[model samples]
Target: MEVFEKINYLISEKNLSKKEFADKFLSLNPRLRTTGEAPSYSSIYGYLSGRREIKIELIPYIAEALNVKEQELFNFDLEYSTEFNIRYSKDAREIIELLQYAPKNMIEHIKATLQKFKKSYEDGVKEPTSS
Candidate 1:
C-alpha cells in the first residue's frame, strides 16, 4: 500500500477524524507549524486525499501521535522484516510483564486512566493533572 493509503487506514483504525488526527499531530509536534498556530486542516486533507505528500520528517511525529511505530505507516511485510521485530520486541515484552505482575487494582487503575484520557482527548480537555 502507498503511504497515503496506509495513513488513512491507521487513522480509521484509531477512529479519529482528519481534524482530530491533525490536532493530535500538531499537539505532539508543536513545531510542525508556526508557534501558537495550529496546522492547516487543508494540509491534512490534501495528504489524506493523496493530493500532497506527508513530509518524511513528520512521519515519526505522526506515528507517535497515532500510538504506533514509525515503520507501521509504510508498506512492509512484517514477517520478513527483522527491523519490525527489533523495534517492537521491547514493547511486547513490557506488555507481557505488565500483564503478569500487574495487580487487579493496578490493572483497573491503568484502564481507568486510559478511559479518562480517551474521554478528555475526545472532549478537547486538558489531560487531568497526574499525581
Candidate 2:
C-alpha cells in the first residue's frame, strides 16, 4: 500500500495514534461513516496508508481537529521555501493576535526589535554604489 510519510509525520507531531485520531473525528461527528457524509474507517486508513489522497475539503477540518494550522498537514519539507512561508504565516497570525492585548511597553519593544531586524536585513543585502 502507498503511504505519504508526511501524513504519518503530522499524525505523530499532533501526538495522535491513527486510531485515536480517527475515533475522535467520528466521535465528534457521528454522521461520518454511518451516514456517508464523511469517510469511513477504511477510507481514513487509506489516507493514513497513502493508498488514498486526502481531499481538499477535509484539510481545514482535519487541521482544526488536530489542533494545528493547515500547513502542518501538507508541508513535510522543512528545507522548502513553502515551509518558510507557511511558518511565517502562522507566526504572523499569532503575533497579531497577541499584539491585540499587548501592553504599550511590550508593543514598543516588539516594534523596535522588528525595525532593527528589518534594517539589518536591508543593510546586509545592499550593494556598494560607485562614486
Candidate 3:
C-alpha cells in the first residue's frame, strides 16, 4: 500500500477523523518548511485527501499523532496474514514488529543468538533420556 493509503488505514483503525488527526498533528508542534512553521490544517487535510503529497519531514510527527512507530507508516501489513494459521504471544508479536525496524547489525546478532538456541535444542533432542 502507498503511504497515503497506510495513513488513512491507520486513521480509521485509530477511530479518528481526518480533522481530528490534523488537529492532533498540529498539537505535536512539528516545525517544517523554510519558514520553520507547522503546516496549516488545510495543508494537512489536503495530504489526507491525497490532493497534496506528504512531506518526508512530516513523517515523524504524523507517526506520533497516529500513535505508531515511524516505520509503521510504511508497513502495509496492518494485520498479520493467516495463511500459515500460526499464532504467537503478544510479546512475541511485539518482538517481531520491533525486529522489522531493528538495525542490520542488531538483526545479525539476533540471528546468531537464535542459531545458538537452535543448536542447543538439536543437541538435546539427539541425546537419549536416561531411565
Question: Compared with the true structure, what per-residue lDDT tens digits does model 2 show for residues 1-116?
Answer: 11246556556755789998788756556334335587888988887787788766666666766776777666544523452544354456467768989999999988887777
Choose 1 or 2, whichever is better by lDDT: 1
Candidate 1 vs candidate 3: the TM-score winner is 3
Task: Report the Cα lDDT for residue 94, model 2.
Answer: 62
Best by lDDT: 3
Residue-level lDDT tens digits of model 1 in 1-131: 57887777678766898889888887875345434454467877887889987766678878987888787777445422554443554455467557878889988888888788778767987555553
Locate the minimum summed-lDDT window of 10 residues in model 2: 78-87
Model 2: which residue pairs collide?
none
TM-scores of the models, in the order given: 0.51, 0.49, 0.59
Model 1 per-residue lDDT at 34:
37
- In model 1, the Cα lDDT at residue 54 comes to 77
Considering TM-score, where higher is better, how would the candidates rank from best to worst? 3, 1, 2
* Model 3 lDDT tens row, 1-131: 57887788778877899989988999999888766999998889888878899999999999999999899888655244442222332345479869989999999998887777667667875433432
Ranked by lDDT from best down, the candidates are 3, 1, 2
Q: Model 3: which residue pairs collide? A: none
Candidate 1 clashes between residue pairs 3 or more apart in a chain or in different chains: none
Choose the strongest candidate by TM-score: 3
